[model samples]
Target chain A: MRLPYLLAGLSVAAVYLVLLHVGEGRQREAEEHAKQGHVTASYAQLGKAYALYHEGHWPLLDTRNRHFAYDLGIVPKGYAIKQEMEKDHAPQAVLFGKLGRHAALSLVPLVDFRNYFYLGFAVTTEEEGLALAKALRSGAALDRDIKVAQGTGTLGSSTLYRLHDDIVETLVMDGVLARQDLTLPGRIPVIVERPRDGYAWVVFLDMHVEHLRYPGPFPLTSKFVDTLESDAL
Target chain B: MLHERYDWLDQARGFVVLLLIVSMPTSEYAGDLLTGDPVLGPPMLNHGYEYFDGDPAITTFIDSGQALFLLVMGFVGYTAFTSRLRKRGKGAAFWYCARRVGVLYALASIDCVLLELATSGKPKWGDFFYNGTFAMIALGTLCAFLSIVVIPNADRRMLFSVGLIMLHSLLYAFPFFDHHTWYDNILALPKFPFGTLGMCAMAIAGSSFGQWHAMDPDNPRTGFRKRIVPVSTAAFVAAYCMDWVQPAQHHDSNAAMLLQAMYIGGFMLMIFFAFGEVGFRFPLLSSLGRNLLLMFALGGLFIGIYLDCFPKEFLLQSPYLALLLGGLAPIVILSCVAVFLDRRGIMVRA
Candidate 1:
């Protein structure tokens, strides 16, 4: 509003825009460093080892389940994918590419519309993830949500808590919810198994549902959780 | 802990922190998008997340989120620095600001180290370059730079701020420089010339506004706020059009940048007036906003610990579930914490 302020604001804004544009000008790598992982992998507190793919084990790929990244693999296809790849933080893997094509070809169901039942899987240890995978392979129920209950207190030198719950938090969601007893739809369950051997598995087999057509039993289900579990590291 | 004098600033500050915190998946929520019904739901997109996937457009949302914080940093920094400069003279003001910036730099570095350890198990130098904390470093650097260079005369400093923007345009004209140095000098210089310079531009822009406001903090220039709105609105429309035509993050024209700044200015003024007229109400948000810096640290810790202990997939089954359960839940806890801290007379003064 003040002429000086206006001029100055415009100038500063100009500098920022140019610098950003120029930084991306050559398009360095067109890759995101956020680490590739199953949707659930990004949820819990897994340290640096928390990504979907770690030590040759891919969270979704190893089991019957797979994560189709919302913007990463799906949505942007072919040329669009190639051009817009720079925006995302993860680089697409070959397997993700194949899944991208499959999703693109599918008809009748809009992938964007059914984002409700997306389940996530995470664990404290890679070994635990493998063990959970083993358990799922032996068949961990997909139609029911899993619960370890928050405030379970130190289970095995570590805390046994709610894997997930309502409330928008920053960074990590503090698990003390439902008065230490977390309950959700059984099928979309994440069991943050008690801290075992200095490692507690925080499994996020969860989904965020906004608008739904059917009232109960939110429709998404996968055979992957039933057959896949993590392999011992 | 709203200071009677600058409650609006405190409110806006907290809101910026809140907006940033809310957008990403938090310690509890993970911001996961899930379907309530598991009935043969479509598969998770392999690569993941489109900007348009949600009701609110993610890209524009992110863009708008950034708009206010940048302005706030400048407004707060300039006004505070000017007062100090008046009291202590140039030398004292310069060192005082530098010391404060040094503290910010130190904290920002710690955030980087913490993030790396949370994600990778070890702290590497690359983390300094990689994480968003670099922005903080840049902000601190800009504060020092502006204190010495632009804190002399309000009118001259205001004009100087405008000059920085024009210089930015000139740089774009050459367009041959590369920013790889931004990555290279991460450890030695931290946020050096380019990154610090760009941030400096934005903060100084805020300073110009602050300079104008300092003339009458209690009674801000009504005409200035009013005049900027339409100009900003029109500029925003123009920027949008430019974006539509060019549409490259890396190739936006200077004209586009000009309009975008105008738009952001307009948006900021609107927010100030809107909040002032409506009167602040959201206690949790205000609390979080008030204790913004401390919470930024605390919140980052919460995220780091959870992220390390749990993977993202461990978040609620879907984002919808996240919204209902994960989203609003933590605000209450955090706000209580703020109130508790405020009562104890504890706060991050910087």
Candidate 2:
């Protein structure tokens, strides 16, 4: 009979309506903050430094300075980049996290919305940041994407490192070891770079995530790359 | 002889296979969560589109696919068992499947062990005996085989399915399941496969569907839309609206299971009817469905093999292009393999 199906349908509908009401506020807040102006504003106070690397390695840039053609989808609050750091670091957990280790890591979700980019910074005691840098230089767990080989970038010795078949690339600065795990899976074309200083960065482009399952050529490609290039922290 | 090409089943399975393959790169199994022991095999190992970074839509979709897989498993299992019963008799079918399920269990155990060795240097006892989907499949088959053979009455079988799931649902009411108690790991042993009442319930529902399909004189193709469209639409709407479930983040939660059923059931009805005309028109998906196990294994290895062997730096320059290609890698390889297997009549049922 249709009884089981009907009851299931009604129960499901009722439950969902209640849940939608509860989550509406969070959804609206996420949409409001996701505005392009709100996102780029985070770097406004930092002056032009956020845009240029080492005073002038790359020119200052602004991205998505306008509308989000189709709002991708709201990511639940406080969801971390554990997928990148945790899964990637599972093999190296012994050497990475605890107090006296190779490097201390800080993974940040750029905006509260968390669709686009996740930034990772590894700070080491003393010159160990450089030591960690050297270890990264070894390319321990990553594969080199030969299509865009080292020194292929317009910038200083810029190279790309990726796990095979992966979309996100470790955009190694001057060939410094980039964070292998600082990735936004499914959203490729994002950059994971480490500059001359001990600081390492992950600039994820939300365009890939937002535009997937929709239309062609993925608009905003240039905007994302420019933002990453400008903010190659 | 292979069952007259059940176009819907083939497409359904191919769809499941496609979902699994795509979800792999996008989702990473929670190894940290898998540590110690788990009740439902590390939250289904599917975090969804953002590499398990909590993409709600994709996560729900994946969950529904998995649940439908269980349902299909029961339907197909019952169909196969009944067909075999006519040829081999009821007792023979029963024992034969017992042995068959044993083999499946052995393979599942080996898979778990190998996965552990691959990811973590050391393999645990649980890896060999209990882990991931193998146990779920093997153990679930055994449970269904027993239920079908013993409960001959259809009405009773339906009640049994409902009762079994309700009993399973009680495990959650216990705060013990929620925490990291020492016993939680110990309890996970029995929990493999038939341990979760929800899983058993799903299998029963599937078997019932299969039984119905076999007996019904009405053309399934024509009757499908009339019977399924409304139910499926309702299920989907209800499932999409599910927010309290946090379906993606917590795999073992009941919400995840319910969402999976609704999504899978609804999507399946829509897809089976919509793509029926065109889906099988492509030879690759059909044959891949036939030789699914092999293609699935091959797909899982697509990335791993690439990581170990090739080193392409150019992919990063154009991430979207790389992503587009990455999605295509499995399809291309599967198509090639499907073509090879289809031509040769090679099929791996398990």
Candidate 3:
């Protein structure tokens, strides 16, 4: 009876010790998993920076690079680029443009395309708009058979145009000429600000882009120009 | 028959038992109210002042009830030990005493219902109703015991008592089966059907022992002493062993283990002393144990209400006078009420 009791006591003690050790080990493993998750999040942020660089849109590329660098504590001295960029337009708008550009560029590498093209035209004057169109046609980077369409006059203003094709699309209006949807040459986007307060500013605006239609005569039509002023207001 | 004995010892014992039973559930709430720190939360440095800024009465009630219950239990235990012991006929008298307990239970039930209605449904019906039911059941148990000891039909007595025991066990375990509150499943019934079974078993067990004593009066103390000492020692040992094993979970740590062991050990000792040693009978002390149901119910309500009202400091103070008063006030009030009813012969039956 004494031996049996002794043996049972020893066995239970051994089991408890083993359980303690196992519990400690599990706790350590959980800590390691948490560390791994943090590292993975940091890597994702770095990947975003690399994509920004390839787009050649230095304004956006510089800003993202600096933000990540600051977060990682690698940059002892903060970069003054954000202060400079804010002097021109809203920081949010700049961020949105970069994100949109990056999304468009992601589509490029998937397709077996060699070159990507973008076009812009101001609709205020027919002559200036046609001149820009001629310039796009003549450019070595653009495809020869670029598709086009046009918008209709909804209000007093007449100049609104929508354009699209197998290779490229354009929406031109007064003070604006938007490249409707063109993939960047690589899996990254070029973030360039439209000339501030210039006639080209409308090219970056959403109203002209939304009115852009497809399956028409020119990549952009006279109707696109007619709808421009009404859409802008 | 009006028996104006007014035994302070008995009344005090009852008061303490009632306080303990009632306070068990309220202790958790009181801890929360006084500390302002919930059992599971960050410790509250300012006590429950922030949480219970508007409610002081509830805090006072809890503190007073806890302190008073502890005092009464301690006081009664001491008084019963020093006082002269009473010797009575074991078999028939035990049954008769148990049945008489039902009247006290009925009065307790009326008090419970009044308290429940006064509390505006804050306290659970189970807490109050279970007390009355347990008392009634205790009466039935006494009857069963008397039948076994006085009647000669052994087979019939054994069968009936066995059935009652099984039925009572089933009722106790009903909560596990239904996976619901014990009150709704067991206490909610009009006759406290499950508890009655336990009462019947107790009665039978009491009767069996009583009859054995009656048959063999020579050195009756020897037989009881032989069983009591060994069983008490084993229970104590078991409690100690349980305390030695520390579970891994923080909630199941050494402190909890020890507390649980002590509780079990205390219960075992109480049982052994109450039934095994007949010559050591103290009516006042045994009555407290016998009326555990009623006392527990009243204690629960008082504790619940007290915790709802007071802060921890009132109960945890150094001199302990505040704690003592806080705990004792409710029991004293309730006991006074019980005494008045006892005098009037207005016994309650659940």
Candidate 4:
């Protein structure tokens, strides 16, 4: 009896490995195409990767129950509306005692991601955002105490601010910071300054590269806003 | 014959629960207190455990005490379930298991709510399922009930366990959605690597071993050595091999559950063979083993209250003092409760 069960398990495991290898192969191809600037091909490969690897809707049993779309994928209208509302206001100051108890500090109400690149949003007044951005840009030249390299490329409507700090560098070196996705390559810190709708929204990129470099093809644009606004409707 | 209590099993469970009780406070407070100090931190905190994610190197069976508990429960719980089924019939057995699940669920919910209130001054309804150990146990028990009702045979239960784990392994391969925020990984929210299934698999697989012991109650140790030992060893090796293909993180993958179940099985086997008599003499172990759910729930509640009242800042002032008050104090208090309950012939099963 054990022998038969073992044989069956081995068979299933072999199939699982084959599927895994094929899925991973497609995923790698997708990444390669993405790097090569083949957006359509990359996306096509990604879809194939999903079909092979993901047991979407549990097709094996034709179970009516659907595999849950992860929280990051589904952007509910209410949450988007909340993000829009929060965009006009500063982040609610959490009490010191409540800091480590919950994930409130790490919770970004609005986010968008494509491949390895992630864009996170925080609410700040327009004046504060501009003043801070301006101060950072100016402070790079004057302030020897801090180092900030302004990136030449633009991230949608925002100006890319590449921050170089010893603490972050040490953290990256020591591998102290955890990546959002385990599959992502190491860790790096980058910040973007986006001023929009009478608010200086501090747009943060969720990149986990080895070193700070301009992430390729910033996709969060007017379309992102349009999508959110329309979804809110 | 199957209804007979196993002191060694209870002692092993007591040991696991003790680890759970200590590790929680130690990780929460001591990690912060002694993190950067050159002399006090490194090796002392090196073996310290957590309910980890993603990182394969740090993710071990040792990290998840919850998995250990489930493994033990898988044995005794299944044996007890079978005993009840034989004596009282299906309805009684199902009711017995259902009531246990309900109690566990209630305790887990209360623990989450109390901790939330302690920290944030308000209870977040969403966080009620955040307590991983309790949630896993409750759900695992429910799954065990279902599995027993549907596939009671030990051989089939083992097959079901293997199949579920295989499915679980495949499920994680396509986590296409980027978890960019902390909320994305929240247990309350729908996410990949639903650990309840993993726990269920662990319980079912565990019950297979329990069945072996039951088959030869007169010579259970011989049966354990002949059957459970080799099988567990093979499963452990298999799980380790599969883990290389995909890193096994606790509650994140079914492979991790298999690894942990084997790990705990091996540990319990060690206790059974060598220190079986030692465990039999330990009344506190017996008490803790019997009142597993009650102790765990109360321990968690006490930890929450202690953290809230004392706070980390106060604890940090004198790290050694904090270690004593924050860590040892709760264990001592819990031991007293366990002992008192034991002496009074009280056993809170759920």
| Share of true Cα-Cα contacts across chains kept by each model | 0.00, 0.00, 0.00, 0.14
Off by over 4 Å in 4: A1-10, A23-233, B30-54, B113-132, B176-190, B251-254, B277-281, B307-323
Q: Chain A only: list TM-scores of all candidates.
A: 0.24, 0.20, 0.22, 0.18
Off by over 4 Å in 1: A1-233, B1-4, B26-58, B63-67, B114-141, B144-195, B221-223, B226-231, B234-238, B245-262, B277-280, B307-321
Per-chain TM-score, chain A, candidate 2: 0.20
DockQ of 2: 0.01
The alpha-carbon deviation from the true structure for residue B129 of candidate 2, after best TM-score superposition, in angstroms, is 3.3
Model 3 CA RMSD to the hidden true structure, in angstroms: 22.8
Model 4 chain B: weakest 10-residue lDDT segment is B178-187
Q: Score the docking of each candidate (DockQ).
A: 0.02, 0.01, 0.01, 0.08
Model 2 stretches astray by more than 4 angstroms: A1-233, B28-46, B49-58, B115-121, B153-159, B179-196, B221-250, B253-255, B273-280, B301-303, B307-314
Best by lDDT: 4
B170-285 per-residue lDDT for model 4 (tens digits): 66544442211212221122454356667778877777777866767777676577767777777778767876676565545356556656656765755654577453456677
Give the per-residue lDDT of model 1 (tens digit) for B1-350: 12134666666677767665554443232233322221211122111123123211223333433334555666666666656667767786677576766666666667667656887788755435422444443463465346436465555654454455455444433324432311221112123234334345555556655555555556665535644454456656766865543331211213344446546654655576577667855555556656766776676667444335433354436756445434554455566788888777676655
Write down the lDDT that model 4 would get. Answer: 0.52
Clashes of each: 121, 10, 53, 1
How would you encode candidate 3's per-residue C-alpha lDDT over A1-233 as one tens digit per residue? 79997998689657644654554455345434333333222222232343355341111111222110112232122111132244444343222223212421111111111111122222233433443343333442221222233331111123322212211222233322255344312211111112222211111212111112332222233443333222221
Top DockQ model: 4
Over B1-350, each residue of candidate 2 has an lDDT whose tens digit, in order, gives 52456766766667667777765544432223213221111244354333323224335456555556666777778878877787768787877677767766666655666666788866665534533465655656776777887886544675576555434333332322431111113122224222344555666666765665555555665434443444446545644544443333224424335545744654574576467756544445567677665666566656555533322344435656445554456466667777787789887664
**Which candidate, 1 or 4, has the higher TM-score?**
4
User: Whole-model Cα lDDT per candidate?
Assistant: 0.43, 0.46, 0.34, 0.52
Candidate 3, residues B236-316, lDDT tens digits: the string is 464345333321111111221222222333333344445544444434344554344455656545655655554555445
Pairs that clash in candidate 2: A145-B312, A145-B313, A146-B312, A146-B313, A147-B314, A148-B313, A148-B314, A189-B319, B26-B51, B64-B260
In candidate 3, stretches whose alpha carbon ends up further than 4 angstroms from where it belongs are A1-233, B1-102, B117-176, B180-196, B206-220, B226-309, B313-322, B327-350
Name the better of 1 and 3 by TM-score.
Answer: 1
